[model samples]
Target: MTNFPNPDENHASARAGWEHIFRGGDIPPRYRSLAEPNPQVVEWADTLPAGGLLLDVGCGVGRHVVYLGGRGFRIAGIDISPTGIRMSQEISAQRQIPFEGHVSPMTALPWPAITFDGALSTSAIHHQRRADLVQALAEVWRVLKPGAVFIADFPSTDTLDYQDMRTRVAAGQLTEVEPNTFVDESTSPDPMEDLFLPHHYCDAADLRDLLRHFEIVRLQADLRPVTTAQGSGKVGKWVVWARRPMTT
Candidate 1:
């Protein structure tokens, strides 16, 4: 998510960082698995009626798009990288999966209101600044049909790694330009370059505020082990599955 170039010039540094990261041709193994829909995502999507329109926000290289579109879902994907969008389009064509891919920022999605029956913003969202995150979530809420489902994940502040990061920031070992937001720099000898990108980690209160427009069905922390260039440890991730209230 941090890899997305911010539309505003104030985030020029962040944009440069992201552009450099995406310039690499190597596709991480973790992302390769995304070429197929996650079982959890499939389970959630199955609940929707047939012919539902689904969106893949921050869809890098169109993995989810190919998987979901091949299954007959009318799929659309958006990403900040032109290469990602191009790759996505190429993959969709190769797989013969009908899809539309756009190069756009998640904060400013180019879609009409109530346009999607379901949406998935996976492994994204955390890259945004506070205001951008707010805008992105609002856009998600706006584009989703009433009673539609949306699932997303972001980093969580309720973790040891978060505390460690904060401690480093407190000691001036790293920079926190915005509250709970980190900029590019790491204490690790060989930090995961991407980890240094701008990231906003949130707490439960933050999640509640972000999801206020929707009826939250599930909100939980995913404690998964991850290693940065600095060290190896577990970081908590926040997963939210929610629905737009029918009355709204």
Candidate 2:
């Protein structure tokens, strides 16, 4: 059997990042977006049969989970952060919403094959290295029933922030160990310990190649507003909605 890294081991940085942001409480207003679900997800959900099961991969704080659950869909959410899962559970309970929350990496989901009718991964998958990102996408594909739809948003290489990062790499401020991969360091006011995490940026062509197995429904350029930490202007992302073919 292949040994998958436990959340505390290989995924420590991701878990720590989210735990620090959430701090075991209500999700910050900027991150809490239950009132407005992703438009693509909303459109796909409308077409699902009654009582469809939807999986929210990298579901931080259960924002989408709660919203979809309240809409009568059976919801299941998974995230690498224990704190995130806890917060999601607490909020769901407080809101009287029913859903399953699991603390696990997207690369290795703790579920059987073809378990969900739909899946949504927003602003999440890009956190991993390319290998892990591929594994996560394959896992997502594996868990969805044939003809099911999946929507995801990933950072694009065309973003201004990415260009700036490249310039910094040239100046040796940050390191790029692999193509389109960066070893991110905290640029905080005070000195901080390094997480040694790998962040990957993808272009539209890369995504098309990676997801060649699925029929592409729509792929559009999305601009994500960044906080001061991420620098000025909006970074780019590719939001894709695709469906698995009914037959292999």
Best-performing candidate as measured by lDDT: 2
Candidate 2: residue 181 lDDT (0-100): 77
Any runs in candidate 1 off by more than 4 Å, and if so which? 1-7, 10-15, 25-36, 171-173, 185-191, 224-234
Q: Tell me model 1's lDDT, rounded to 2 decimals.
A: 0.77
lDDT of 2: 0.78
Candidate lDDT scores, in order, read 0.77, 0.78
Q: Any residue pairs clashing in model 2, and if so which?
A: none
Instruction: Give a tens-digit lDDT track for model 2, residues 139-221.
Output: 98899999999999877787886787698789877778567877656454112322245567788888898788888888888
For this target, which candidate reaches the highest TM-score against the unseen true structure? 1
Query: Model 2, poorest ten-residue lDDT window?
Result: 188-197
RMSD (CA, angstroms), candidate 2: 4.7
